[model samples]
Target: MNVGQPKHLSRFPAKTDLTHQEFWRGLPTLQAEAVLLGPGRLEYKMLQVTGRDLLIFRSKVAPKMASTIVPHPDWVVLMVPVDWHGDYVFNGQVARPFDVFVSGGPDGYSTTGEKRHNLALGVRKSSLKEACANLSGRYIEDVALDDQQIALGAAVGTRFHRRILETIAASLEKSLGSGKFALDAVVENDLFSEIANLIMAETIEQNSVSSINLDPVRVVRRAEELFEDRTTNPPSIADLCKAANVGTTKLHLCFNEVYGVSPIAYLQAKRITQARCTYLSAEKVPPSVKDAALSFGFTHSGRFAKRYRYFFGEYPSETLNKR
Candidate 1:
């Protein structure tokens, strides 16, 4: 995470020649699990300001996709969806285009949308606090908690909020022609301050609740971690419930809220992903598809092949033979 000055400052054309791996590698932060939901080629374009701890970027994704993201630890992202129609799920709560969302630290989030254009700014936690304090005379000590609560409470956007977003976009467009230059610290600070002031002045604030009530998100995250750790020997639903300290019914609800799937189904999907990775990475005489599937906990080869094809749009054998 070394921030350097952006060498290029132009809005590039929509790049359609990226593979799934290439697209994932280009993302600034966040570990994403992505699934292309449409048949057409994925189209994307980005305008980014490089080389500063406080960075601004706008990107558009066409031909719908579903993605789950784990945010970066040191940055807080404020995102405004332009020409975006879909819901973003954060901590089990959903936010729409007119709602601005904030995220900090490592949190799980999911976005499913069609042809989305988003303007996002990533600022370090310390810079964000300084900006907010300079603008509003108040500081946020725990940004991740505050952002989660805001998302859970559904912070709605107002006319002024829309105007702020428009202004920010306009500023980015103007700066695109400025060429490569080291971003001045004072200039970066002022820019962040302006954005923070707009957010503070326009967005509505709700009451903060205690952490005891927010245990469901934590439980779901813990279950996901456990599934990842023991992919070959995943825990049963009952075992997961015991580990998460929740009942079967509560676990189901939490899993559905976060992943749109039951715990068992999510685990199965993870196993399939692991199997695909193993199949693709095998070198010097790859393993048979059956062996790969069974190695990742797929008991029945036939069922595993069907599930793998359905999820990845290719048969397991096809993937196994590619390399």
Candidate 2:
């Protein structure tokens, strides 16, 4: 695959004569309701790749301004503030600069003191799940950050993190400008995978501080046992919580602390691993990807293929073909 310019791009130039409605319309992934507490201006831009969406925006609003964001179901939002001060309140927590917010849930609200500039990435859920699988051997659908925010602090300043961010920024800039390139599909997949992995890894590593006290060792072992026993049909989060004799919040914290992924994500990885093993072992006459997926409780072959590619960095067909 060759790397080339993206086939589609959208830009919304900065304008001082912008209404709240206009600013809301310019947002890429979410339908937001913005209330301007005082005078200010908003500028927005967006770039779309095959499977990912990038957004850059700057909002100058009053200290009391707030916005409610509702994200698309199939996408997860990653907010990285570029230049700004003040905090965003979401999920009953405050998010500040250098903190990345990853959410794919109910309506979220954010408020800033004054001016705010940030880059938000809208990634498909499958892509993020695959990234989590690659990084932690788990298929995490969503990561709940500490107080709904992952504080980068000195972590973002590190050479490694800076390099990854720079690379992503450069790619976006190139795609936004000349818009000419020959990027292979597989190569593009790998590039996005790497970017997601780097960002998630850094976020997980830096946000390791958990205020909740729980026996991570015990919780992990019990959860592992439950997943092992019910490999064919995994238990739900509620079931896991009930079996573990813990609430949902504690379960999440415990799993995150021990495995760097949620319980459900770990279960997903286990099932995918099982499916892969079955497919690989069917040597003489392999079952089709669809067959494997169905045998493992996946009804949608298209989504299965995407998740499989994200998790293993190759298509299910490719995996079977290797044999």
- Could you give candidate 2's per-residue lDDT for residues 1-323 as a string of tens digits? 11121121112222243456754553344577666665654433322232233333323343345667776666666665544445545555665545667676656445443455444555565555544434443325444322246676644424323432333333342353222112223223433444454455555432222436667778667767776776655554544554565544566778898889987677567778887877788555768886666556454467778988889999989987787
Model 1 CA RMSD to the hidden true structure, in angstroms: 21.1
Error of 2 at 294 (Å): 38
TM-score of candidate 2 versus the correct structure, residues matched by position? 0.44
Q: Show model 2 residue runs off by greater than 4 Å.
A: 1-30, 42-64, 86-92, 139-147, 157-191, 194-323
Lowest lDDT 10-mer window, candidate 2?
1-10
lDDT of 1 by residue, 1-323 (tens): 11121222123333234444554464456686778887666655655554366765556777678777665676777765545545544445555435556666466466777767666666776656544443232335532224632321213344434333333333342353432123333235335545554455444232122235756688798777776666545444434654565544566677888878887687678778877877776455657886665455453468789999999999988886666
| TM-score, cand. 1 vs. native | 0.45
| Index of the highest-TM-score prediction | 1
What's the lDDT for all of these models? 0.56, 0.52
